[model samples]
Target: MKRRNLLIAVILLGAAVIFYRAFGTPDQLATGAAMVNVTVPELSETANEGEAAFNRLCASCHGRNAAGQDGVAPPLIHKIYEPGHHGDASFLLAARNGVRAHHWPFGNMPPVEGITDPEIAEIVVYVRELQRANGIY
Candidate 1:
């Protein structure tokens, strides 16, 4: 009888663990809910050229304000891409060479074609300004 009870308890504990992993913890659920909705503020054109370049090149996937398209790409306004975490050089590298998607489930980011280094710099400036305005900095 004691052995049967212990087995039942272990099975119950295992089921609970599996359920949590599949459904996620409360905090994970909350975070997911939060990410589902995001507010993108109006961009202050600190770098007009950059803004133009971003609109011409990156707006489709990243959104006009860099708020990011759901399932397509992650938002740049998020803290994950803050300057401390992903610097200006990271943007250049991403433009020059495709980046492996490590942060989001959107898969790999293909390298942008036909954009000059100077243009990329300008886009970086624009993105950084947006990040700052949105308090991601």
Candidate 2:
């Protein structure tokens, strides 16, 4: 009975090792989580249309220059357009689902509900272009 129990424990331990190797450790998991939040740049084709759409929809508060509205809104340029807040995926999520400054305290950004997905994609393009023009990256 003792030998059998030891064998079972060894098998379980081996299985655990295999699982960890396949899935990674908690630290690796955390790193992946952090990576998941990283904002990627936008693709090239839609950049122009995005700029136009932005001018049409988001410019009033975000500004024609994306520099902020003094009392109304925050700048969507430079650091604010960095990974966490202005990444492509983050942009898509914000446009699609709407955001309220989950990562910042500047102020809550109201949802843009009437716009469609294609429009949001174009906005993403424009934002990427704006960031590049601003030399953010």
Candidate 3:
């Protein structure tokens, strides 16, 4: 009986999460503008390299400094991307495998091609620094 109750509780919790995700607040569903203002910070060597790579690979969609493009992609500097929520590994996975749209209405992200794991790591560093500088961390 205890196990059954625990399972029911878990199921309810999962349903609530799904409901919230599907019907998030207006801010989370915001579109057609830069979601947040981002503060730039000093970059380490690796981060600098990553910045260049990001410009080459991701900026067109994600926007300059990853502030996000309207009707394109969500900002990396937002609270949803803080390390506690979507951690570094999530970025790696997204870059490699893409992700379904849950937070925004921009639809799914396609897997980024021709980027190596090391480059993605550097990009994560660059983004993390940006997040920290902007108080998202």
Candidate 4:
């Protein structure tokens, strides 16, 4: 009887593993945890203005320093977002028009309202500088 129960337990465990592997994020993102450790560098005057704008507009979801909030958003400092792949234009477009979820499990990002074109541009600069500081470039 004990052997039979053990075998059943093993089967259940295997099924759980498969389910998680198929639909789960293997990192801390699900809990809204910070996904990466970021090192901030001194910013240019534009970047500094961008940082303030980011804090006001983007920080609620993107997290402080753009480290990313698990289950909320992906870090801009990640390699997938390096300028070559995502580019400056992508960021600009995303702020103006919401972006669909393509590279991440965080779902779609809606268009950010009440922010101007110039502020969004500055935010991009801040994000790029942060990415550079973190060795993502």
Number of the top lDDT candidate: 4
lDDT per residue as tens, model 4, 1-137: 99999999999999999988667766532777778998999999999999999999998898999989987898888999999998999988998999999998788999999989999999999999999999878
Q: Please provide, for model 2 over 34-93, each residue's C-alpha lDDT reduced to its tens digit, 9 standing for 90 to 100.
A: 111123355366866776777777777676556655445556776767656556787777
Could you give candidate 3's per-residue lDDT for residues 1-137 as a string of tens digits? 99999999999999999998677766665555765788888899999999998998988789889999776798888999999999899999999999999997778999999989999999999999998899888
Q: Which sequence of candidate numbers ranks them by lDDT, best first?
A: 4, 3, 1, 2
User: Across residues 1-137, which tens digit of lDDT does each residue of candidate 1 receive?
Assistant: 99999999999999999988667666544221223233444655646788899889887778766777755677777899899999999999998998998988677999998888999999888878777777778
96: Cα error in model 4, Å: 0.4
Task: Report the backbone clash tally of model 1.
Answer: 0
Better by lDDT, candidate 4 or 1: 4
> Which parts of model 1 have CA positions greater than 4 angstroms off?
1-46
- Please report how far candidate 3 places residue 19 from its true position, in Å: 20
- Cα lDDT of candidate 1 equals 0.78
